[model samples]
Target: MSNCKKISLSQILLLVLDIILILGVITTVIVYYNTFFKGSGNLNGLNKFIMFALLTVGITCIFFIILELRKIVLTLIKGNPFVWLNVKALKRISLECFIIASCYIVNFIVNFGENKYKFIYLDSKGIHTDTEPIIFILAGVFIAILANVFKTAIEYKEENDFTI
Candidate 1:
């Protein structure tokens, strides 16, 4: 317990951003389910099942992300080691990045086909095409890296504190 009472403004900003990201995730899930799955007469049974599965997974991920964010916030409040908090957060963020990137790749492949074969398959009847998964992927990756950096910084700080 070093007498370090100074809180970095950047950490405050990161906490705020994490809160916003959690809210955005929730909104995205709601919009996705409502727009894609509600009263859609186009999809057959199998397709409907697949869509529901995807939605369920997406919602579950959002819940996990929120949980990780909460853990990080708790760590900050308790003034615990950042590395411990970041390990959990970074793992979630990395998984989210991979999931979002894979989803985009799958969507692209399913819709357009491989090797320039112009096969235009609709994702669903009423689903909006405006949500680009690439953005999510990139954001997830960025946050993951940020978390790792925080972890590293804390490790360095601990080392310096011990050297004195």
Candidate 2:
């Protein structure tokens, strides 16, 4: 744990955010311009629009998640990881995760019932699998629990301070 302080995580997260932003722009363009994607499992017409919307929302949520992570990392750097701001940030991140999960799950469902290709691949590649919804949903639940733990920690710290 002591060795971990030598590295700057905030900068790493910032770099990650920058990458996500760049990739997000490229992905948004690709998703919006269905013509660019000429292959099976590609979206079109109303389906394209729906996919574009979902992808936009998912990217936006991820951007916000990184922003909140930056905030939390800043707090950690300040040697105060149990602050209320972090709790709020964690709660926000959890909510964003849930929203992203919902979007992917919706996309999954929308594509599942259709005879045509969906925004997310439900088949092919010699296997059938979709992990986004599960991953985000689990992240949401775990982060929410962590937020509660932080809240409780803050309450305990406050109580300890007052006892003196």
Off by over 4 Å in 2: 1-42, 114-128
lDDT of 2 at 45: 84
lDDT (Cα, tens digit) per residue for candidate 1, span 1-164: 89988777546855776877778777876777675667566656766666555656766676676667667766666667476666768778678766756665664555464443322345558434434566677778788788788878888988999999
Instruction: Assess the local accuracy of residue 62 in candidate 2 as a C-alpha lDDT between 0 and 100.
Output: 84
Residue-level error in angstroms, candidate 2, position 150: 0.2
lDDT of candidate 2?
0.81
Q: How would you encode candidate 2's per-residue C-alpha lDDT over 83-118 as one tens digit per residue?
A: 999999999999999999999877877788565433
lDDT against the true structure, per candidate, is: 0.67, 0.81
Error (Å) of candidate 1 at residue 41 is 1.5
Each prediction's RMSD over C-alphas, in Å, is 7.6, 4.9
